[model samples]
Target: MAGHSKWANIKRQKAVVDAKRGKTFTQLSRAIILAARNGVPDPSGNFQLRTAIEKAKAAGIPNDNIERAIAKGAGTFSGDNHSLEEIRYEGYGPCGVAILIEALTDNRNRTAADLRVAFSKNGGNLGETGCVSWMFDQKGVCIVQGVVDEDQLLEASLEGGAESYEMTEEETAEVVTEVANLEILNQTLKDKGFQVTDAELRWIPSNNVEVTDSDQARSLLKLIDTLESLDDVQNVTSNFDMSEQLLSVSVV
Candidate 1:
C-alpha cells in the first residue's frame, strides 16, 4: 500500500467498524438525500443517486431509511426543511502535507469553526479555497476484490477505458479512470467476472510527502481522524505517506 491506497484501506477498515456501531448511518442517509436532491430520485436515471444508494446499502443502512431519504430529497416529505450544501475545505497538515475535505453541511459557519478547531489542535491550519487543491486531481476509483488474473484485468482495464490499475493488496486491486468512464469501467470489470466491491470519485494526490518522523505521522493521522469524525464531513484526502510501522502506531 502507498499514499492514497494505504489511507483508503485504513478508511475502509474504519468504515466496517463504524457501520457495526451504526455511526455511519447518518452520513450515509445525508449522502442519499443530497444525491437525490441534486438529481432525479430514481437511481436508474441518476448516477450519483445510484452510487449513494449502493454505498448506503453496503454500509448496512436499512432500505426504509434509504427510501425516506430519497423522499426527503425529492421534497415530498414535509417533515424536514434543512437544506444541505456540499463544501470542500482544503488545508495543510503537519509537515506541510496537503489535505482536502469534502463535507455536506446545513451550517457553513459551524462546519468551518469545527474544522478550524480540529486543524489548529492537531498542528494544522485550515486554508483558503484552492490553497492545496492544486496538488490533487479528482479521479474515479473502483476497488475490485479477490485475487484477479493480471493479464485478464489488464485487458479489461484497457477495453474499459481505465487510466491505470494497481494491486493495492494481494487480493485487492485499485482501478483508476476518468469520471466519465467510471460506470463503463465498473460494468466492464463485472462483465469480465471481477468482483467490483466499491466505486467512487476521490481526490488523488499527484505527489506524496514522505513522513519519516513518527511524531509527524501521529499528528497527521490524528488530524485526519479528527476531521473525519466530524458529522458534516464526508471524506478526507491527504498527500502524505509514511512507513507501515509509523502508520500503525500513529493512528490510535
Candidate 2:
C-alpha cells in the first residue's frame, strides 16, 4: 500500500474517536457552511452541500446542527457577521515532502501565521503559491469498506462513471472519478449495496516521495498533525511515503 493510503487509514480511524470529542463535528460544520455558502442551502439542489451533509451524517453529527450550519451559511441566521474564504497553502516538509493545506478562515492573517509557525517549527518551510500544487491533481475519491467482492465493486464503480477503482491492502475499495461526478458515482455505489466509507474531492499527488529515515517520517507526520489541529485547517495532503513497518513504529 502507498504511504498516503496508510496514513489515510490511520486518520480515518482517528476521526471516529475525534467525532466523540466534537472536534470532527466542528470541522464538519465548517465544511457544511462553506458548501452552503457556495451553493444553494438545499442539499438536493447543491452537490457540494449534499456531499458535506452526507459526510457529517456519516460521522454521526446531529441533524439539528447540520440545519443550523446551513441556515447560518444561507443568511437565514444572523448569529454572526463573519465571512469565510477558502485558502490553500503549499509547502515542503521533512525529507522534501510536498504538502498542501486547504483551509476555510474568516481571518487570513491568523491562519497564515499559524501555518507558518507549524511549518517552521516542524522542519518545513511554507512556499509561494503553486509551489507544490502543480504536483497534485484535483479529483474525486470514494472509499468503501465492507464484505464485498473486489471484482463486483470494480465493475459497479466503472459502470457508475468511476475513472478507476482498486482494492487497498486493508481491504477497502478506493474509487476514483472526475470531480463533477463524485456525487452521482457515490449514490450509484450506495444504491448497489456498497457501504461507502468516505467520498470527497481532494488534491492527489501525481507521485510520492519515499521517506526511509524514521526521524524524518516522524517529523513529517507531526507537521501534518499540527496543521490539521488548527481551527481553520480543513484538509492536509502530502506526498510522503513510508514502509508499513517504519510507519507502524514511527507514527503514533
Who wins the TM-score comparison? 1
Locate the minimum summed-lDDT window of 10 residues in model 2.
15-24
Over 51-97, each residue of candidate 1 has an lDDT whose tens digit, in order, gives 89998888778899999999988988877879889999999999999
The alpha-carbon lDDT assigned to residue 111 of candidate 2 equals 95
Residue 17 C-alpha lDDT in model 2: 69
Q: After superposing candidate 1 on the true structure, give the runs of residues whose Cα lies further than 4 Å from its correct spot.
A: 19-22
Clashes of each: 0, 0
TM-score of every candidate relative to the true structure: 0.96, 0.95
Would you list the clashing residue pairs of candidate 1?
Answer: none
lDDT per residue for candidate 2 within 39-85, as digits (tens), equals 99999999889879988998888999999899988988776788888
